[model samples]
Target: MDTRDLARIDLNLLLSLQVLLEEGSVSRAADRLNITQPAMSKTLLRLRDVFADPLFTRSGRGIQPTPRANELRGELQELLGGIDRLVKGEAFSPADYDGEITLALSEYIGVALLPPLIQRLHDLAPRLSIRTITRIENQLEQLAQGNLDFAIQIAQTTYPPAYRWQTLGSSPPAILVREGHPLTEGEVSWDRLASYPLIRLYISDLDHLEIARSSEAFIRARSPQQGSLETSHLLTALEVLRSTDYFLPGPAYLVRNEQATRGIAALPVPEGASYELQYRLVAHERTAHSALHNWLWEQILDTLRGLRVRTIHRG
Candidate 1:
């Protein structure tokens, strides 16, 4: 049979045919379908004309399905099953979604930012699982190959042609220090900041160079013993600063969250010494519009907007 001819077939007839084949009697089939016996008999007549087969033959008490009907039964059931799945959406429940969705995020962003969103996802979809990989490594390739669903990163000057991005929010970088740090007592001048050992939370390779370029005057004034300590991970840098005199420069919004303990305080980075970091949600252009993918995209934006509004209200 021509495949296109199959496309013209009425799907409701196929369902009725399946019911008749299973029941082996028009009255029984009508009972199963909640239709009148005469209506089911008319449907069976139509099915016979469409397939040019006497699908069932009268026996003593019940009808017996013809060989052709028996042969088509399994195939019809399979086709209907596929259609049901397609219409109902994926079998992923929020609580039992076992399929893995990989995301690319910096250690700092993941630690300081993603906790609440993760909790919300768990509450909404108990089974949906998430795996976060480092954002700075092979991000475009990972996204292109379908290994990653989305990425959260500080916006940069350029991105690969294959990917697209949406800005979440932007915030001025602030100095994070211990509560009783000497700089917090009064105005923190370049010389005063230079005296303390700086702990750098470096997310990308370019951050180090950018900080040096922006803070050249302070770097020149600091003594050799007051050099900076570098860590590839943001959370580690924050933990280090919490214990010792080391200072960290990071986004003020991230530090304002519940993660920041009473022991730490955010201070303004003095004039000409501040940097702007933009939070961005990124994904491959190809899959950006998919239902689940777009849902996640909006969630990130909503969360960022709520946080920004709350900050404004507090100030």
Candidate 2:
């Protein structure tokens, strides 16, 4: 129905009429709906006025439906059934899902997370097309525009009303170095770490937002940003760490147990460095009710938890 027509009509009257039609007794309908007799009588009056018909009549036992009320029974049941189906969508199956899903995350985070995550997607949703974007400059704006379904990045301290986010986990960055590096031999201190040139893994999206107790912020406070190399790709930065005395500071938990990180070791940031980041999975309000979006969201969350658990067990 149109908005103006709907505004004048009370949907509850239709439901009350449905119950009254089924029970054929005002008192019985009131009892079923847990309402007082007078309340039920008032509802009947409203229903009559809305439908412009004396829908019921007094019978010797209880009541009898007028012809109009009898006329409404079959259509009312069918309409209500249709509405029920409309509210509850069909059962979701990943195999049936062939929709495209776009996820925005850094390449480093994807390196360790994507393998197991994609494997699950391959097994479950073979027909689905997936695209991952890296070096995201403005994830929030992208989320608002429906360009990205979800973003895995350093969690912000606050978000504006148009967004929704969930914390994936804490992100304490690790100083990744080649195996048998001098830092691996002994305790890592600010001065000891400062002695080596650093590799900055820039998250292009986070540059606009201010993060509290951020790993990069803490390092800037302690030492000069002495980067021998700064790059977007983790593979390239890790290759640099493998060759020279440069140290790469980035997401350690993601690559800790990965086969690609075999020759690399993730050492803790020096003591008193307030570099703990809360990684958030951010999405727009538009996708809040979407079946495919919610399913993929759960899969990403579950896959991340599984990754962390395996890291713990291996440690």
- Among the numbered candidates, top TM-score falls to 1
lDDT of 2 by residue, 1-315 (tens): 599877987877888889998898999999998999999999999988888999999998788999999999999999877877788976778998888899988887788689899999999899998899987777898999999999988777678898888888876777789988998988987788877787777775565444534555435633565556768887888778788788876766746645677689888877775466667789999999988889899999899889888878988
Q: Supply the global lDDT for candidate 1.
A: 0.75
Residue 115 deviation, candidate 1, in Å? 2.8
Model 2 stretches astray by more than 4 angstroms: 1-92, 208-227
Query: Relative to the unseen true structure, what is the C-alpha lDDT of residue 297 in candidate 2, on a scale of 0 to 100?
Result: 93
Tell me the lDDT of candidate 2: 0.82
**Per-residue lDDT value at 219 in model 1:** 52
Residue ranges of candidate 1 with Cα displaced over 4 Å = 1-65, 80-96, 205-223, 232-235, 313-315
TM-score of each: 0.67, 0.66
Which residue pairs show collisions in model 1? 94-125, 94-126, 94-127, 95-125, 95-126, 95-127, 96-127, 97-127
Error of 1 at 119 (Å): 2.4
